[model samples]
Target chain A: MSMNDLIATIKKVLEEVDVVLGWTRSPAAGVAVPARFHTPDEADGAIFDSTCTHNLAVHLPRLKNSKVGIVAKGCDARSIVQLIVEGEVSRDRIRVIGVPCPGVIDVKRAWRCFGFGKKIEDAGGRVHMEGRSMPREEILLHKCHQCQDQEPVIMDLAAGDVKSVTPPPPPDKTGIRERFAAMSIAERREFWREQFSRCIRCYACREACPLCFCRDACSMQTREPHWTGGQVNAIESEMAQQVRTSHLAGRCTGCEECERACPVGIPLMLLLEEQNRIVEELFAYRAGMSLEDKTPLLTYDVNRDGGWR
Target chain B: MPKTEVKIIGFLCNWCSYAGADMAGTARMKQPASLRVVRLPCTGRVNPLLVLKAFREGADGVLVSGCHPGDCHYNEGNYYARRRMEVLERMLPALGIDPARFHYTWVSASEGAKWADVVNEFTRRVKQVI
Candidate 1:
């Protein structure tokens, strides 16, 4: 319900887990940055505000050997659920402190508008910064504009008022969505080619993905199979992204971390969102929704899969 | 612009489609020369990326052929391959490849005639698109 409730919950959870992954306000950045708390005393620094946009579950897979306590927003919890279903993290070894999200703001967007490192706050469905206020809907992350889970999907401990948040409104069928729908297959090919031409191949998109936990074994950079070339040109970059999008066909949770992390600002979500939509339409399945779900691509229903043909 | 010869990459499962193609060849069945065959153990080994790679390498079309759904040599390989191919087929359009450029179908070892007909139709279809 409040900052105290979030801190108190994390403190309680810290007793049972080795580390609690949450957000702490940064003095220099003037926004919430992800931090790990090891003790009840460190939990005092934990805060859950609109600026706490980082998904803490990205840290869970790397810490497979230790018990972890994660402060999960509704979207972050989906990533955690997916990790559990994939056997990357055991559910029992981790504690989930669910924070009923009120849709986090895209702090970079805010900074771009209000000037960087300004005191930004969210209150009464609006974002406030440096004596200027704007409607919260105008500054929220694109993922938040279409958020389906205001309440965490799975939680061992509830930290905030789960009932207080309302579902996100339907997204406007304009901008990228409308333009994407209007483009033909040939046109889309050109669009993506032009877009990927600017890619520097930094691999920030891969690194920020919570589900892309392949680390050193990632095929994106593997030289043996030589999936993509070492060059940073349009063809190689586009193929690298194709590898990512195809591999994430049924597993991506639409967290948009990959797009957000991309330094060159490639709209990676366009490919991912399209694949997610196709997966849902064909199989009637949404990734990371349940622990029992086998990835649709990994399994088959011989008698029932006729419509796709 | 001058018309280019359509180059199709055919990934055939060894037990059925590959043998079926061999039979067609030995029978001297008249078919287009567009398709080049790569034989794999089963359709299950036909990863979707292989299809994409074929396209990237300038294959005008890709055809994956295996045993009929209930008749895989491995009993279940084609069943799994069926789902993957279906998914990959749906994704082609999104990647800007004409959906008509890729196809997957079943061809039993004895169906030499059927294999010839499939190759004729698919190559004709690919020629139309390119």
Candidate 2:
């Protein structure tokens, strides 16, 4: 369906629900931002563009007690299923209006698309994608190409007509593991040191993550005596990286929001992807794959056979 | 090879592995003194992060020992520990740590000799690398 038809459906649904959560072009930027529509009239600004990279599922748990209507893409729907499985949100409290996304564009790719000399400006809720005739494929988000599922896993009301699309192939984690293995110890240390040095201790990544639900009591915020000093030095950087990565070990849904939110352009998703790969290899488990599957870490079995001990 | 002093942290399940270590001491079984044992309620309580944290805190090696798989005092504690450790073992090498540095073994309360042997072998291997 056209973007107009999708917005019209969302308008109707927004009038019936307490709130309709969707993406609106950020007022000050070329990026998409999450917005809540309580009235049908406000739906005109909602756009389902290639820049709509924000996963709407992050808002569901916060509005769990209230009836909410969400505009979700495939990855967003997967996150919803995961939240339901974890008992973080009730399925009955939310209505998912699914959309099939081809792929969203990364900001760096957008910059490159616009060319080194040219600058693209955001004006009146529209992005002018201009430069030296760059192909659209060049600007697409890396995760979208690797996305295995295009159809929403769970949806109460799908907006566009359902289209049968082949899921992307399973990620080649062995290749990725080999790349890391090939790096020398000094090279690995230097790489991480440079990446972590750029981190300004901005918790935007944590705040943007849908699964990182811990609020004020965040590990990074403990300061009575200060577990690790608040400085963005190497020791503190390493601690922060370890703490953040470990927290998302089994829980990360591979949303990539944390990486996107990082102003420093840290490849945070690589760490998460590695963790996801490990989880898959060991237990044959995938996070956000199904609402019915419980986390392997939280569940125990006496008769289970294939483990180390 | 130059001999490097390797620090090893051993997490022993209180019900079995810790008792097994005590039994080994009572039996005067010779074991490597490089290990620092932390008594946990059960091996299942050992989060993979703790193992990583051991390495982060300069432990050259980590050992998690529990009751024989089915003999968990909590019935399924060791089984859960086994699953977590197995996953950690597979992932550690990718994170730039030697996979052999993290070891998981089952030591029953009566297996004093076995516990000593496991520690000696693990310490020796860690020494070779560190």
Candidate 3:
């Protein structure tokens, strides 16, 4: 189904549900943000554009016990599944309208593609790409190329007809590990030092992550004998990165929101991908695959297979 | 001659290493006096983060001793502990920590003499690094 059809389906569902929560083009047409519609007229402004990158499920629990209909892409559905597994939200309380997303473009990449002097505008639900028409490949997010699962894992109500096209294959870890192995110890340190120095401490990466639910007690914001001093210096930034990466070690769903939200382009996913590789190699566990399965690090069992010891 | 002081936090499994340490003391074996032992129900209970926390809190070294792989009181506790430590060892240098500061060993209750040897070697190595 096309973008218009998906919005129309949401409009029909919202008449019965308390609210229809989904993405709409931001005032700056190049971006999309989560928005809610209580009435059909409000739904007219809803969109499913290339700029729709934010996972709508993050806002679902905040809506209280009210019945919510969310437009979930592949990543959004995984967040919904994780939330249900954690008992944060009931599956019955949510009506998932799944959309097959081909991935959204990064704003920085978009700027690079279109060059300066170009301005973006959101007209109703569509992004009017006025300034310059660059090749789609030039502006697409990197994570999209690595995405293996494009189909919604869990959906109560589907919108677009499911396509059978195979998604890009699972990332070749051997290639990644080889790249890391090739780097000299000193070069690796210098590389990370340069990447972390650009961090601005905006916390958008934390805010964008669906699994990072501990926003209230985040160590970055703590002041009592501060774990990390509240500054963007190299040491503090590196510590913050370590803390954030460790916190998401077993829980990161690999949605790539943290890397996407990073204004400095620090390649935050590299840290997470490395952790994921370690967990998989050590315990043969994968996150966000099943609600029944517990995180390997957090769960203890004496009788499992694979004799590592 | 001045003696070097090394702060070493040792996590011992209750069924084996803890008993081994006790037996070493009962046997009056001459072990290093620097080791501070914390007995846990099983080695599986020792999270790698706790070991990192000990280092971050200024311990010169950390030692995690569990039952020999198959001899865990709970049957496989030592196995899980071993895997966790193996992975953690790889990431230690990346976190700017000397990998030698974190040690993992298999000590059975019968090996009271070996427990003394483990502590002596660990304390000596820690002193050298510090």
Candidate 4:
């Protein structure tokens, strides 16, 4: 479907729900941001394309309304399923507008191609840099390089021909974990020590996470028992890192928003991708894969094989 | 490596494993001096974080001993703990920590000789690693 068709649908959806959510162009070039549509005029700005990268499902509950219409990608649709399964969001209240994904422009990777500070728009497979152009294939975000869902798993209304599209093969995580595993214990400790040391203790990774709906009620903000204070000491730094990532043991969706939001550009997703792999191997659980599949930590069996050796 | 004894931290569940350690002492069984025991009400109370905390506090290794699968005093506490530790051990290597540095087992309060054997065997292995 074209942008006009999407706008018409949004206008129709707005009549049913409290609000309609979709991607609209931000003031910055090459950036499509989450936009809430309360009226037809507002919905006119909504567009669907490669630039529509933000997973809009996260903003649904944050809109603070009982019922809302939101757009979802294959991955975003899975996030909605996991959220509903966990009872984090009400399924009956949200209307989904599933859109086909052709790999969103990862701004950071584009920076390496377009020379750091230039603003540009993406047209299909071409990166339009002012008057110059190149294939958009060269600069996908690290996670988008390996997107497996070209179509939404669940949707109230789907835009474009999802059935005709075939998803590219999922990226194999070969050598990713082994790269860190190959390091000596002391080398690994020093590696993490330096990484955590750069941490200014900003929990942007935590805040940007969709599954981390706990918000301010997070124990990271606590002081009485002091799980790990906001102070940036080496011990506290590692403590904070340990608590935050470990809490995502079974629930992470590999959205990589944490890596995206990090001001210092840490490879947080690579680390979490490894954790998700381990959770899958040990318990045969992959988060957000299906609503019918329970999270590994949330459910267990007496016959499950124990990995302690 | 130094000839000193390894600093092993044991999280023994109060209902079975803790009483098992006491039974080892009462029987005058020859147990290794390497282990420093911390007893909690049940293995369920031991969060995976505590094991990480023990390593951060400079422990050479961690041993989580609870009641046998069907024998937990709280009915199913050890069963849950078994699941948590299994996943935690699988994750340790990805974090660059040697998976060998962590282990868990089932031991009842009456198995004093078995407790001595488990402690001696684990202490020897951890000492070799560190």
Question: Chain A of candidate 4: what's the TM-score?
Answer: 0.89
Candidate 2, residues B1-130, lDDT tens digits: the string is: 8355778999999999899999999999998789999999999899777887788778989999999887989888877777778767876654567777889999999999999999999999998777
Clashes of each: 1, 0, 0, 1
The C-alpha stretches of model 2 lying farther than 4 A from their native spots are: A112-128, A164-181, A184-186, A223-229, A307-309
1 versus 4: better lDDT goes to: 1
Question: Lowest lDDT 10-mer window, candidate 1 chain A?
Answer: A169-178
Q: Write the per-residue lDDT of candidate 4 for residues B1-130, one digit (tens) a residue.
A: 7346789999999988889899999899998798999998888877888888788888999999999988888888877787778878776765657777888889998898899999988888887777
Candidate 3 Cα errors over 4 Å, as ranges: A113-131, A164-166, A169-181, A185-190, A223-232, B1-9, B12-19, B22-47, B54-61, B66-87, B90-101, B105-110, B117-130
Per-prediction CA RMSD (Å)? 1.5, 3.7, 4.9, 2.5
Considering the true interface contacts (CA pairs under 8 Å between chains A and B), give the fraction that model 4 also has: 0.36
Ranking by lDDT: 1, 4, 2, 3
Q: Indicate the worst ten consecutive residues by lDDT in candidate 4 chain A.
A: A169-178
lDDT, candidates in the order shown: 0.89, 0.76, 0.74, 0.77
Residues A116-206, model 2: lDDT tens digits: 3233333332345552344334455557768876788888777776464435433333243466557865566666777788889888888
Residue A35 of model 1: what lDDT? 97
Better of 1 and 3 by lDDT: 1
Error of 4 at B97 (Å): 1.6
Give the best candidate by lDDT. 1
lDDT of model 2, residue A59: 78
Please identify which of the two predictions, 1 or 4, would achieve the higher TM-score against the true structure: 1
What tens digits encode model 1's per-residue C-alpha lDDT throughout A1-309?
789999999989888899999999998888899999999988899888899888878899999999999999889999999999999999999999898788888787788899999988888888899799998877777888888877888899998777578779556432886787789988988988998999999999988999999999888999978899969898899899999998998999999889878877788998888889888998899999999999998888876885564
DockQ for every model comes to 0.72, 0.47, 0.24, 0.56
Instruction: Say which candidate scores most in TM-score.
Output: 1
